[model samples]
Target: MHPQPESGTGTTAGLPATADGRTSSAPPSGPAPAGAPDDGRMTWYVYLAIVISTFGGLIFGYDTGVAGGAAGFVADDYGLSSFMEGVVVSTSLFGGMVGAMAGGPLGDRYGRRPVLLLSGLLFTAGALISAFAPGLAVLLAARVVLGAGVGAASVLVPVYIAELAPARIRGALVSGYQLLTTLGIVLAYGVNALFGAGQAWRWSLGLAAVPGLLLAGGVLLVPESPRWLVSRGRLEAARDLLRRVRGRHDVEAELHEIRAVHRQEARAGSGGWRELNASWVRPMVLVGVLVAFFANGCGINLVIYFAPQILQSAGMGSSSSLLATVGLGAVNVVFTVVGMALVDRVGRKPLLLAGAVGMTVTLGALAVVVSVPGLPGANWLSFACLSLYIVMYAVSPGLVAYVVISEIFPLHVRAKATGVATFVIFATNLVIGLTSLPMLDRLGTATTFCLFTAVCVLFVLFCLRMPETKGRTLEELEARFRAAADSRAHARVSRGV
Candidate 1:
């Protein structure tokens, strides 16, 4: 049987103790304030917080997608070779790698809110600098800075939403981040088309600042993650915020559960690289890192960052390629919506398994179609395959990666673990972004796609080791892992190993 959390009593910390003995400094219990709706569907503040946090996702999507289209124009204007183009496009991902590494520790130490605010500022600054950069060096520098913000947001936004949302709808709410990301990609495609004629890639690059600035301001109105507050021993603050977001729900029971988990974590050790040595944490972190690594290894970035280039190679004109990219973006958004609706209802593992199967099939077909000489309508066939690939990806790894990483780790180590995983993701992305153009030039498109197809086949094997995480509370999931770890340790001791 799972262990139940012990009830908290009088405060041991500096904060005032609640009636239950947990530390608290909130005002006495009261009814919902006037003008704050009490209908229990979810307060306006909850919805507002979600909307504000997801702007970061929107910024993430725009910055990443803009590069795919902007690179062509920038290459034309600057007279760039394949290597130089790779540097320009991959620079932001390098920044993202740094951001993901740093954002985790900072978010864990400070709070999710402050880190998000800083990310927004960085996003704004980076966008403006990129838009007006006079030389390739300046553009690369600007993109790195902008990429840092995207990286930070990628790590933080999903965690923030996961913490705030109720378990019942957590999948749907977390997928909102992915949804906004798709919207941002769609917007970038439209912007790319608008400026493609004039080679005004600057406008395409610069426009990301608009959402960046809005996110910076909008986050100011949202509350900090209650879980973060609770971890810091700000019990009253956590309780008050929980009540506000959870409406008429019993905040006390949830608070007690969190308190029990935190106490358990404290006994385990303050979470860090050291704590990760524990058998329980190792499996979770390993899975998280593998998921992040393989998500990129599947070559989604190849599609998003170089769709136009790929299409052009398949005998399409520049205009036709750009239009097809726009179509790809549309398919991404539509299918992502479908995934979001099903995430909560159908569960996470099924979607992941299904997506793996679909991608493997489509990517394999793409390789064959491209490799075969003189195949009729091969270009259109490749296009159809690419579209289907996005559909499969959107349903599974694309949406599931963010949701799973945020959900799997213990609360104490969440930020740090997520940071490590996201760092792996962007680092992998950086390698892919840098090498894709050169690989295409050297290895040819068919061979390159076959390599990606192989990765998908490997990913299917990886999914077999993954645990289904749908519908379980964060506390429950953590306990389950802890129990398994304990069992393994006991068996080892019995064997005198």
Candidate 2:
């Protein structure tokens, strides 16, 4: 008889699950099929490890908040114009692109744990240096260093969690990254409200090191990814770790499935960066890449990074603006929990489509309200529009993009392809961040917002075309896409086109 794996939650304790916590359709008398998680109760150790690793995301959220919270103070001390303030705020984003471009190769070559550790160190160094920066140039350079670390962790964390999680609960577990990140943003905003009086913004900036330190220490306590170990030929170690993570002594079936997929990928000569353009691979990679790109285009990060500034521009006091930002950050945290519950339960595309429509409407409201001067309660109305926008964003593109990209690609090329996707996300974010203030200054708030509203419309169209990834194992997803590609090619040849 197969063990009835407990989800460690009272609600799911009686369900019978395969090795990795996926509910089996029947109580089979024999062994599971090759790709199943096998026979194991999903353990809290897996949960603990994933949580610790996801602190990398918290570090990212902290940086976004602390910088935005303190940008005005930073600008006042330096006597910076809007362009220079944007330059200071966006330097880390530019650094993120550079770090993101390198993150894939590093995670693929060095194991995920080590790369994560290095990212923590970079965050630590950058935070400390920025706290003591003597000039704009010094602070800008330190932000670049800090951005690189967060960039790498952004690529590494999602794939790391996806590989370790049971397929049944992978959606919720992976969403933990976004949860922690939002939590971090809230914490930073709180810190800003506390310490943002004078030059005290330095305190908010310096404290980012705390989460960075936690990220490194947490990685130290967890084992490396079993899938990556298999790729590196550490089969014995991979097998042992897999058994422990699955909570069963036997993982031969799962291990065999992983090996077989690698062998298939090898025989097909499909793992190289150049071959990402090949017919079988390109479709899925395009899906992942476009999903990543539009996720940022949804404009949640824009608010996270610039809410205080956006609010202050609308005739609000500095303290009132930071407090309003805290409220928005809370909305970001709450709805992300909603996303965690709904992602696997409903589906990826549906949540995203729903979000895009809501965002377009809210953004349109923002453009209309911000453009009209002396409108009654315009400050409060702007706050309401942003709050609603965060709700839409946090539940969909804000959370799901990372989950889809991490699991959609075949393992053989996952690192490189995910890297490319990660690079696009960071690059898109950089453009949004670097240009936000200048756009708000020159084009006016209403027009600037309308541009993002336009992007959400584009996001809606993309969601209609993107594939759903709910309930499918990584290996299953790869095979499904490859078969679809083959079918399309056959149809084209049949018509002699």
- Clashes (backbone N, CA, C under 3 Å), per candidate, total 2, 3
lDDT of each residue in 46-153, candidate 1, tens digit only? 899999999988998897788878998888888999878878889999989888988988998889999999999999999999999988889999999998998888
The alpha-carbon RMSD values of the candidates against the true structure, listed in the order shown, are: 5.3, 7.8
Per-residue accuracy of model 2 over 40-75 as CA lDDT, tens digit each: 257777988898988988998998888877787899
TM-score against native, each model: 0.92, 0.91
Q: Model 1 reaches what TM-score against the true structure?
A: 0.92
Model 1 poorest 10 in a row by lDDT: 31-40
lDDT of model number 1: 0.85
- List candidate 2 segments past 4 Å from native: 1-35, 38-40
Collision count of model 2: 3
Q: Give lDDT: candidate 1, residue 178.
A: 88
